[model samples]
Target: MASATVGVGWGWWGGAMRIPPFRTSLVVSGVLVAGLLLGGCGTGTAASEAGGGGETQGPCAASGGAVGAGAERDGVRVVGVVERAGAKESASPSGRVSERPGVSVTADSLPGVGAAGGPCAVQYDVTNPESEPFTYTITFSLVDEQGRAMSNVEETVASVGAGKTVRRTLEQAGHPAGGTLDAGRVRILDVERVPSDEAPAPAGSCPASGLRLTADQGDAAMGLRVVGLHLENCGDRAYSLEGYPVLQLLDAEHQPVDGIEVLRGTDGIPMAGGDDGPPRPVTLRPGERAVSGLAWRNTTEFGEAVTVPYVRVRAGAGADPVMVAPHLDLGTTGELGVRAWRKDETDPGAGEGGNGRPGAQGPYGGSSTS
Candidate 1:
C-alpha cells in the first residue's frame, strides 16, 4: 500500500436547519476586561473578613442577596448565587441563611478575577440535581452593565454527585485582536453533561469504556478552521477502531442539529494539512492515542450562520458516546470535512495535561498517514 499523503479537504460541521439564523460574536480590547476586574479575590463568594460589629464587607457582601439576571433555555440555566469555589451551595458567604437555591442571575461575582489573569470573568455554582455523579461542561459569555456581549468562555467540571453543588470561576479566554469589551458581565451560555464514568479526558483515571476521547482546540486563521478529535486507550485492554469516528452536532439546547454535511476525508474544503486517506483499521494500546479532525470554513453570505456548540462522538462501533464542545461556528458554508482515523505520532510524556500526549500538527510529525 502506498503512503498516501492524501485528501486536502480539511473539515466539516453544523448540521441541517432551514436556512439557519445569523450568528455573531463580539470580541474587543482588554480594556473591557480590565475595567470590569475586581480589586482582588479571596477564597469564596465575597472575600472579606470581620468588619464593624462582626460584619463582613466585600463585593459579594449581602445586600438583600446578590442581584443580577441570566437566561435559561433547554436544560441549561444561569442563575447568580455565590458559593465557595468547588464547594456546595449550602455554604455561601452571604451569611449562609438557609434558603432554597435561587435561579436568578446576579452580579455578585462581578469585577472578579479568575485563573485567566484577565477581565471578563465570572463564577459558576453548579448544582447536580441528578441522582448519580456526572460531568458537566458549562459555557459562559461576558456582557457589560447593559448586558451587551463581550467574550465567551467554557469550564468542564468532572463528576458531581447527586444533590451536590460545586463552584468555579471562568474568565474570557484571550485578548481579541481589536475592539472594545464591556466591563464585568459574565453569564452562563450553555451546559452539556454526561455520566462521570463516560466523561473523556486526555489523561486521568481509566474510563469504564477502556478508552478516553478528547477534542483539541484546532487552529483557525482567516476563514479556515481545524479541530482535532482524539481517542486514547486508558484501560488495560487494547481498543480497535476502523473507519471514521461517528459524530453528532448539537445546538446550545442540546438538540440534534440537522442539514450540515459530514464528509469523508478533507476534500470538501481544500487545505494543505490534515490530509485524509481512506478509512482504515487502527489499534491503540494503553496511553496511545488516535487523531482525526473536523474542519470547515466560516463563509457567510445572506444565509444565516450555523453555530454548533456540542459534538457527541463515538470512537468506534458500540463505543460509548462522549460529548465535546468544539463550538464550531459554520458560517453558512453548509459543508464540513472530517479526516479519517490515523495513528498519532505525538509523544505522551509523563502524563502532563490531557492524556499526556502532544500534537505536532501539520509538518510537525505529530500525525502520520502510514
Candidate 2:
C-alpha cells in the first residue's frame, strides 16, 4: 500500500492546506563538525546521568505517538496528553538541581540544491531558568534513522544563568550546490544540556561505518549510476531507517553527470512509492527510517573522466522538506552522455525516456535528434 500523501509542490508550501503549520524555531550554535570521532559519548557518559531523581514523570513518547485513528487526518497526526497541554515539565541535568533554562531550538533553514540544498540549521533560544550562576555544555551531532550516532562536536557555554534564554545554531556543512535530503537518515541528532563542569569525554566507536552502493546489471548498459544523498526529516519527530541507499551520479569535478531532479515512475510520475510499487505512506514510526533507491542516466558522452553522484533528499511534517546532497564515486567508463528527453525532445539515448527505466528501441527505427 502506498503511503498517504499531502503533496505541496516545491518553493510554495505554506499556502496549501495540505501543508500543516509548524513553528520554525530550531536553534543551533556551533561550527562545521570538528575532528570528533563518529562514536557517541557512550551511554555511561556523565551527560547520560539523569537528575529527575528517576521520578515517575509524565509521558514523553516519540513525537508521533499512536493516536486514535480519527486523530490523524490531512496527513497530520494529532497527539493528546493526559494533562493540560504546555504543563510545566522538569528535566534535571545529570545530577545538578538548578533551574537553568535554555531557549527552544527550531529549524530555521534547510539544506538542498536546484531549489534544494542538503545543509540545514537549527537555531536555539537559550534561556536560564535558575537564579544561581551556571554553565552549559552545548553539543551537536548527526544521528542515523535508528537513533545511532553519526558525528558530533562538543562545545561549551559559560555563565548562562537564571531566567534567561540564549540563542545557538547548529548546521551540517559541506553540502553540494543542489540536491535532495535522505529522508530515511534525516540527521536530527541529539541536543540537550549537561552541567559544564561534568561534561563527559567524547566517545570514539562507530555504530555503523560508511555506506556502500551496488548497481543492477542494467546500470552498465544504460549508462546509469546511483550516487550519494544527505538524509533529513523536517518533522518534530526523528525517523528510523536501514540500508545505505543513494541517489544519481556526478563527475570528478563535482558536475552532475545526470541532471535528473526527481525520479519518475514507469508512467512518468515522481513519487517515493505507488501502486504495486514500494509501500506508500511508509510512516516511519517517529525517530525511524525509510530508504528509497535513486537512479540516473549519463546525459553526456562517456569518457575517461571519473564521475560522482549525489542526492539531496529532505522530509518534514508541517514544514517544507529539507534537502542535503551527498555523493558517490564511479570510476571512469566508456559511454556517451545521457540525453534527458525534454517535455518535447526526440529519443537520443540508450534507455527509454518515459519512466523508471528507459524503454527498448525497435530494430528498425528512424534516427531523429532534433
Candidate 3:
C-alpha cells in the first residue's frame, strides 16, 4: 500500500489522494471560501430584517404598529388631533368602524412643555351618544412621524351622561427622544366601557379655606406685565381648582380702579402650563400649588400712562376676595387678561421641584407679588 501525501492549502483539504489538479483545487477552494463569506453576509442581512431593518431606534420606535386617526380599534375612534403649535387634523374613520353605544373620544391641542414642567395636554371630549349614561377607560398614545410613541400610552376613566359630553385633559410629560410628535397621528389604544353606577365619584371643588392665593408680577415686556396667580393648598386634604382667578385692579385708595377692564382671553402672551380648554380640575395636596396667568398693558398707543397700586384676586366666583398690593404699573391702557388654572412647574405632583410649596412668583419667576 502506497502512502499518500495530504497537502493542506489555506485550511482546504486538497493536493492529495487523487484529488483534482492544483488549478481545479484552487478554484474549488475559492468557491468554498466565497460561499462561506456569502453565508455570513446572509446571516447579517437576516438579523437586520428581524430587527425591522434597523429603522426602529430610540424611544419613539416602540413595539406597536402605526395607528392612524379614525382607525378604530378596541371600540374607540380618534376624532381629531390638535397640535399645540399647529392646525387641527380630522380623523377619517373607516366604514367598518363601530363605536360602543354612548362612547366617543376626541383629542385636543397639546400645549408645549415649558421649563416650569407642564405636560403635553390632550383634551379629551368623551361623549355618551346613547340615551343611557356610561363610564369608560379611554386609552391613547401620542405618536411621532416614525410611528413611535412620544409618551407612554395614557388612559383616563370618566363618566358621561346620556347624550352629553364630558371633557378632560390628560397630561403627558416629556417629548419623544428622537422624533417629533405627530399630532395628526394620535392613536386610540382602547376604550373599555363599564356601568355608570360603578364609576368613581368626581373630585370635589377646592374650598377657599384650604387655598392661599398669591400673585407675582413678571418682567414688563412691550408695555405688558404678566402676573402669575399662585394658589397653594394650605389644608391637609387635597383640593381641586378649575378656571381663572377672578381679578381686579385697585387704585391707591383701595378702591377698584376705574376705566380698567379685565378680559378673559388665552392669546397675546405666552404662559407656562397654559391649557386651551375650560377649567379642568387640578387636585392639590397640602403644600401643593397651581398657577394662573394674568397680563395687563399699561402704555396706550396714545402714550397714556396707566398704573395700578394694588390688585384684588378671588380664587373662584364664590370665594372671598383678597386684596394684593403689587404696585405693578400697567401703561395706561386699563386693559388686563387672565389664563385658566394649570399645574405649575413647582407643583408637588410635577416632580420638577422638591416637595416644598412653590413660592409666589410669576410664570417667568419674577418678584413675589407680596
Q: Which is better, 2 or 3, measured by TM-score? A: 3
Off by over 4 Å in 1: 1-123, 127-134, 139-154, 159-198, 272-276, 350-358, 363-365
Ranking by lDDT: 1, 3, 2
- Sorting all predicted structures by TM-score, with the top scorer first, yields 1, 3, 2
Clashing pairs in 3: 60-148, 116-345, 298-330, 298-331, 298-332, 299-331, 305-332, 306-331, 306-332
For model 2, give the 10-residue run with minimal summed lDDT. 36-45
Q: Is candidate 1 or candidate 2 better by TM-score?
A: 1
lDDT by residue (1-370, candidate 3, tens digit) is: 0011111111011111112111101112323323322321001111211122323222222222332333345334432222222111211221233357796543322223231012122334565666666666554655555776544343444446777654343334234433233234456655545445433222232443767665542445455566556676766898776777887776754467777677675454333233365667777778766777666655556666767766768778876665554456766555667777776544243312211213332342322111
lDDT of 1 by residue, 46-97 (tens): 3221111232333223322323344443334433323223322211232322
Q: Model 2, range 1-370, lDDT digits (tens) per residue?
A: 0011122211100111222211122122211111111111111101111121221212212122211211221111212112111211211111323334674332222212111112222222345555653344333333444555444433334455555544333222112212211222223232233232222212111112111111111212234443211222223553444322322344422245763333332222222112133323333332222223333444444554444432222222222221222233233432222211111121323332211111222211111121
* Candidate lDDT values, in order: 0.54, 0.26, 0.45
Measured by TM-score, the strongest candidate is: 1
How well does each candidate superpose onto the true structure, as a TM-score? 0.58, 0.21, 0.37
Summed over model 3, clashes come to: 9
Please, what's the RMSD in Å of model 3? 29.4
Better model by lDDT: candidate 2 vs candidate 3: 3
